[model samples]
Target: MTRCALQAGALYESTSITYTPECLDRLRKAFPGDFDDVDEAMRSFDPASAPAEMLSVLRSFTPARAALPGAAAYFHAKALEAIAALSMRPGPAAPKARREDRELVEQAEAVMSARLSERLTAESIAGELFVSRSRLCEAFRRVRGSGVAETLRKERMDAACRLLSAGGAHIADVARAVGYARSSSFDEAFRREFGCFPAQWRQDAV
Candidate 1:
């Protein structure tokens, strides 16, 4: 998992548990094609996305407990299970993710990051990159473990949250800036993502 401060004074907290090389090999074998080079994804994955059962099991373990006799094996197994779940790709396995796919994902990410204020779709992104939508989506899922549309929705929501937290833009303007043309639609989407309306979230954020 990763975290970024939204601004100069912003605070973001996160935690990560790196697997042993042995565990990584186990995960790679378990996930197969989609698990290659997962260490290099530019996009940050939230740990909250991990399976609840795995998280619960892993959470009950600690460094001291992991070192205890007999417990080490159990903890390592649970940790491996959690990472395997976290590494599962969204789409069906096609082939071992290619380095070219990494390049394509990077290009697509750069385009999406630069164009969040504009309406974007798989077709438009593929057109901009001169690649097929299937290739783009497949590459994106393999690299980021998420679909393009889902990732784009998250990008827009994240941008909106940053704007909301900084305290100047009106709700409707925030909506438009994040590519939603209709305030009502933006409001609905915002609530679906964050469980609150834009105005209410802004009030809490600032």
Candidate 2:
């Protein structure tokens, strides 16, 4: 989402950002030492440490209600969303997502695959993809025949099962590996998903 490239359409945004040298010079003057190593700052921005409150605040600047009638509101709303996202990276631009395919389901799947370990929610994932939470879920349901939460849970549980089968990692470790915050929560989900606890499944597999 931070790529900040302005793509025009209903949800109009491309994940790309550009900074001109003139802009850089102005910023350097404003922030001085901070801009000296802008690229380094951007590269070092940790995803885990993304300022949740700050990002939320920046994103909130976008107009909540699409006040404009018809297509104009789409542009107004999403253009601001892109602008807000551009401010996220402390410096370097996020690599732009390819323009060829804007398929939400495919993009969502790719995102899910890449960040299995990190804590994720459908809303946060949607925010990262520059789409509304409802839009994201609808896209999943339409194309994948499942909800986003269901897909994510399945992926996490599948990873957890593989870890359990391997037999070296403890259940707590497995839980964290699959994005659960605690073993208890993981146990509940594991049982729900498989109709058996993780340990029992592993033992039975053995």
lDDT of 1 by residue, 1-206 (tens): 43444877877543356766676555444322223434432133455465576567666676677677899678767765565455442344445678999899889878878988777766678889999877787787677767666677778889989999998888889988887777877887788678999999988877
Instruction: Please provide, for model 2 over 20-80, each residue's C-alpha lDDT reduced to its tens digit, 9 standing for 90 to 100.
Output: 6676555434321123334333445554555564355334444443353564655544443
Clashes of each: 0, 5
TM-score of each: 0.55, 0.51
- Candidate 2 local distance difference test against the native: 0.62
For lDDT, the strongest prediction is 1
- Backbone clashes in model 2, listed as residue pairs: 3-15, 3-16, 3-17, 4-16, 5-16
User: What alpha-carbon RMSD in Å does predicted model 2 have with respect to the real structure?
Assistant: 18.1
RMSD of each: 16.1, 18.1
Q: Output the worst ten-in-a-row residue range by lDDT, candidate 1.
A: 33-42
